[model samples]
Target: MKEGIYYDCINDFLNKNRDIETKKLLLVAEYTNFELKKLESYSGEIIGAVVPFIVYNNEFFNKGIISCDLEEENNFLLIENLKEFSIEDSFFKKSKSLVVLVDGLSSYISDFLDNLFQNIPENTQVIGGGAGKMTFERDPVIFTKNQFCKDSAIIISLNKKLNLGIQNGWEYLEGPFLTTNSEKNILKTLNFKNAFEVYKQVVEKDSGKKFTDDNFFDIAKSYPLGIIKYDKEVIVRDPIFVDSDNNMVLVGDIPQNSTINILKGKEDNLIKSSGIATKKAMEQIDLNNENYCVVVFDCISRAIFLGDRFVEELEEMKKNINPSKNLFGALTLGEIANNGDEYITFYNKTCVTGILC
Candidate 1:
């Protein structure tokens, strides 16, 4: 592995540890809605340098995964062949790790993930899941400027010594325990009611807030969903969408047959959870040496809830992580982490922090 941070306009930061040319890099960036062209233009340069597996965007304007090559020469083929390319086809063989970028409508992510990991190598590590949807476009190298166009994702594969660790903590409320009647990645029903409705009921009853599409965030953002693991151990994930029809709310995938409970959160608790996540990641690694990178998948709800105080958590992570290491991450619709078992767990309403050294 090569050592040192390579920062550029197109490449925000790259920590190469070894002289591995065939580096497996997993890169992800989220941009505002409908800005795929601008986002892709810059991402094209980033992945072109590292040879990414596939780039993804979560703007679920349609029904399938859009596919394309990084090079302009294959632009026509990539878009035209998108339907033919399953999410698996975008990932080539010899992939050592994965880099991902996401923003825009995050609802489609779970749909992509259920299929994406099917053929991935068992040992592969994930590197990126950076913040937000960008609407405006800037140079591939420069990351300044904000535009809300479309949500997108980019993935890269790396080959070399790589490590990743994730930590998250969610407070589970005693009430709001509900059964999952039907589900998919972004859509689900709880107690035969739409996710939004159930949420409305809870908030109106407790907080006296009305549930409406416009006021969904007033009650729904960072809402927690509890899951029953195989051993009956419980974990919570957050919901990302509220489908009006079928009375089901859309969320990242919740394994079938798992019991779900809706949990509530406060701003202070969310920040504390971030600290806990950082500590957990640190606990996973040796921590005897300087780290290379730390990627955070904080729920956007946390950011919206915390506002200015959010940077405190970032600084805390920077201090806890060796100052020599680089840290970057995004507020995502859903976060994925390994639970020290065969499964790479997906979470919502929790800070999913991953450190790579």
Candidate 2:
């Protein structure tokens, strides 16, 4: 295991670590640190992506680079064309688990996830997240040692299975509305009516605040939409804006005919949920490998809505997992994970924790 540390300057890191080609480099950098000048100057297999922020040792940083070494090389896959995402059948033949990262703004990401899970070997779990900025500007966010890509995804297949936990503590506040019209990430209608109209009726009455065009997100962040799966946990989605047609534009896709409810969150319950997710991951740690690494895909919206209190979310996580497990995480535009025995999908407003051996 190579040392995973933060470097403030890309040139400083590139100059000091010039000999890093011997090992597979996993580089997670802030959007400011991303530059692909002279890829030939460096060597070896590299997995790099520009994210909103990276979390190491439970500390949050909006800038700098997080570099470490990864396990296997041949199994790593980079899907540059997300709209027509496809992989050979032989790719996952030797994998036990997967770490996935996709561009958050990609329209075809949901389809990609659906296809990836349906075709992959059974019992192979997936974790990781959507990479991008809070502004929703799309670019070459996903990268490898040689190629920088956008509207893309990168996957690292593992020989070791990861123990996982996924949770977002937003309590239900309203009814089982139907998504009457939807395509990709847009929620066009709810319960056969304008999506924002129905949402405003519920949210305004509950929060005692009116929704203006400018303050829609400021008011809507506290009230997200939740979709319920049969016997599994409820998955949450964040509605970021209301279009002129009153459609609810969300972070991820909300399939038509899906049953959804408006959910409300508090500062305390959200913080507690992090600890619950961490403990759930820790409980499944293999007895043979008592020590495991921690990886989290936490939603960037959670940090924005919580503001300074976001520290409590990380603090709660630190209390549950062992002090020895090295924690690596990112504040993603949208989260990607699947709790065991459930469907793999893109998510929002949730914390995804994985314990890797």
Residue 105 error, candidate 1, Å: 3.7
Which TM-score value belongs to model 2? 0.93
Q: Give a tens-digit lDDT track for model 1, residues 1-357.
A: 223222222223222212222322222333222232333333223221111111211111111112212222211101112112355444546555554543323444554444456656776665434233222121231121232212334455444334444434445654444555555454345555555566567657766667666556555554566776667545655454454463444335555545666666666666666677677677767646663456555555555556677666566566666655655444555555543224545555556666555
Residue 66 lDDT in candidate 2: 69
True-structure RMSD for candidate 2? 2.1
Name the lDDT value of residue 260 in candidate 1: 67
Residue by residue across 191-289, what tens digits does model 2's lDDT show?
899888899999999999998869988898899999887775687889988777778888888889999999999888998998899999888876577
Q: Identify the leading candidate in terms of lDDT.
A: 2
